[model samples]
Target: MTALFVDDRYRGAHGIGRYAREVLGRLDVPWRDLGLDGTPYAPLDAFRRVPGPGAADVVYSPGYGALLRAPRQVLTVHDLIQLQTAWPGRAKFLAYYNGPVRRVVRRAGVVLTVSETSAEAIRAWLRDDSVRVVNAGNGCSAAFTPDGPREAASDPYVLFVGNTRAHKNLDVVLRAAAVAPGIRVRTVVPAAEAAEVRRLAAARGVAERVEVTTGVDDARLAELYRGAVATVMPSLLEGFGLPALESVASGTPVIHWSGCRAVAEIVAGRGWAVSDAHDAHEWAAAMTEAARSSRTVAAPSDAYDWDRTARVVSETLSDVLG
Candidate 1:
């Protein structure tokens, strides 16, 4: 059977986009791209009205873009953070999740997730015992090796990658930086939210110590990872901690909140998972210790590899088609 993978989120720079690009690039199956355009939500709307595939064709959506009544449909639900986190868009998010997304997921032939933690969350949230939620786990890109050109920064800095969303717990990082004094925080946020992140830093009284960067390429991100003392992932929830794996892959340590079950589980015995995620003093102390330490740890068992991930996906799709 021919596999058609949806490329709805590939044009963006978010985690879902990264996952789509990397895994899709490595798949060995007879596949074609069903590309979508416009904003992130457009694909969902489009998918609902889009034509169904032939009997010999299988449709795969790598991210959350699900189809209402497609036969032989596969979906990858990265996380159920929206269902768990309290955000301004909670109402709209609930409307969509409880409406179209729920219908699509219930009809999916196979459901792929990044982590077992997320798989459980999906099962719990959907309350669907029959959904085959497979934990395919993510891998760090080969480009994120230790021996790379490091980014140049004036002082020793803690790296924080990803968007500065409320669930990211960046305020804790800023507060920790403020208390740490000597350590700097280099945050990679989206260009649009840079000003707000900077304002947050200023409000926390660590504006000078916190450097917010926007629109960095992968190579630059790898460089930043290599040069950092430790990567801070104080997120309240994570389906799979990509930054933790990438940091370990880049020969840098990771400091994450212990409450983030996926991150804590992934980084266990590889890096530090602070029990007190909300206590700035505790985070500051951990940062100080990480900065002084020169030890490099091995990548977690779940370290990202697109080829391996694609192979698993290929097998899963084959099974579904059979």
Candidate 2:
């Protein structure tokens, strides 16, 4: 069967965008790209405007382009963070989720998710046993290897990669840095959020110990990963923790919250999981111990390959088409 892949998030730099670019690049099927432009809602417009998929063709979206109506469509839902978390745009998000997103889930032939945890969440939220949800997992990019050139920091620092979303629980890191002393916390965030992170650090009384860097390229990110004492992920929820995997691949230890099952499962033997994400003292002790100990290194398993992911997608689509 032929595939019509939706390239909606191709130009974006978020995890969903990266996933789209990676899997679409390695897919083994004969496929054509359908690009979407304008706002985040543009996909709906594109979906309505584009010609419908033929009987032998399947329309696949790596991101949640669920509004698109096609003969056979596959959607990958990363997480329901907006639904679960309390945010400023809850009203708008709820409206969209209840409107187009729910419609997409109802109409999709097969729904793919990043982890089993996410699959369960989707099933539980939708309360639908008929929905076909599968776990496709995630992989670290090949660039984050153990032999990369390391970046230099004035003092040993624990690295935090990802946006400063409320669920990320960065306040714990700031609190831990305040009490830990001597150990710096280096956070990679967008330029717009740098000031807010700094303000939070000051509010927590650890401004001097916290350093925030914005707009780092991949090479720099790898270097930082290589040199960090340990990468910290205090997120309360995650579909599939990519940062933890990347850190382990770079020969750096990772300390993530145990509450995030996906992160815990991904970093099982290669990293440490703290049971109490809210306890600053516990995280502080863990960070200090990680800095003093030898870096724990491990290579990603064969399962973390884009080729494997593509194969799974291909097989799933074939099953749906059959």
Candidate 3:
């Protein structure tokens, strides 16, 4: 049985691309890497009509950006954030993610997700009970672990990763860091967004303490996590919180803002979850506690392996084909 892991825009930079690569490495099936080679519309449009001699029996699109019209399809809904926050100018976002995209999701044979929180959000948003939930556990392979010459910095700091999307809730971290003079704040993102993030830090009165580094490679990321006091993921919403899992994989404790179901679902007792309503002092306290306990994170379990995720995809495809 052949399973097609469709990721039309397989640019190695983004998180969705990482998910596609990991799942493809795992599933024991003939796979395809139909990236942005041929496209007129968006890269997603190219995926919608991806062609080859080996037509797949089942297709899995982890990004949820592309609509698969295949006979048997599995759409992984990372989170239903489009319906939740309704951020500024959400109408445009909803036009792309809701309605038509959801119609494609309803046509899927199975709905796999990264966390139960995301699954619940999907079901509640659609008001459907039949959606099946499969938690794709998080893991960083041996390749992702720290090894080379770089080592942890001597100073205490909290790390943040991801773009400057409104939902990332970066303001909270900036606020907390401004009050905590002892700890520095570091962020990983594109250089284009650095000036704006710095403006934000300045407005919040932590401009001197906040440091933004653009273009971080995997080795630097591993080294950063290995040395950090704690990794902070304050996203107001997520389909699955990858940073939380990566922190655990890198043996750095995580401190996430509360209400992100993914963080609670995955890390449970392993890390700290703080309320969004908490003031800067409270968050600083949590950061201090996390730094003190950062060394406790262990290597994640085998279930988090990409191979295991691939095997699940292979089995699902075989069943669909049969």
Highest TM-score among the candidates is held by which one?
A: 1
Candidate 2 local lDDT, 177-228, one digit each (tens) = 9889979998988788899999999999999888898777667888999989
Ranking by lDDT: 1, 2, 3
Query: How well does each candidate superpose onto the true structure, as a TM-score?
Result: 0.91, 0.88, 0.83
Off by over 4 Å in 2: 1-5, 41-48, 51-57, 68-72, 87-95, 320-322
Runs of candidate 3 exceeding 4 Å displacement: 1-5, 35-58, 68-73, 128-133, 143-150, 290-295
What are the per-residue Cα lDDT tens digits for candidate 1 across 75-184? 78899888765766687777777776777677764588999999888887888887777888787777787887987767789999878788899999899988899899
Model 3, 169-275: lDDT tens digits are: 88888899877888888888777888989999999999988889878767778777777788888887887777777777777777887787777665665667887
| Alpha-carbon lDDT, every model | 0.79, 0.79, 0.68
Backbone atom clashes (below 3 Å) for every candidate: 4, 0, 3
The model with the greater lDDT, 1 or 3, is 1
Give the clashing residue pairs of candidate 1, or none. Answer: 139-303, 139-304, 139-305, 140-304
Clashing pairs in model 2? none
Score candidate 1 by lDDT.
0.79
lDDT of 3 at 100: 49
Residue 62 local lDDT, model 3: 64
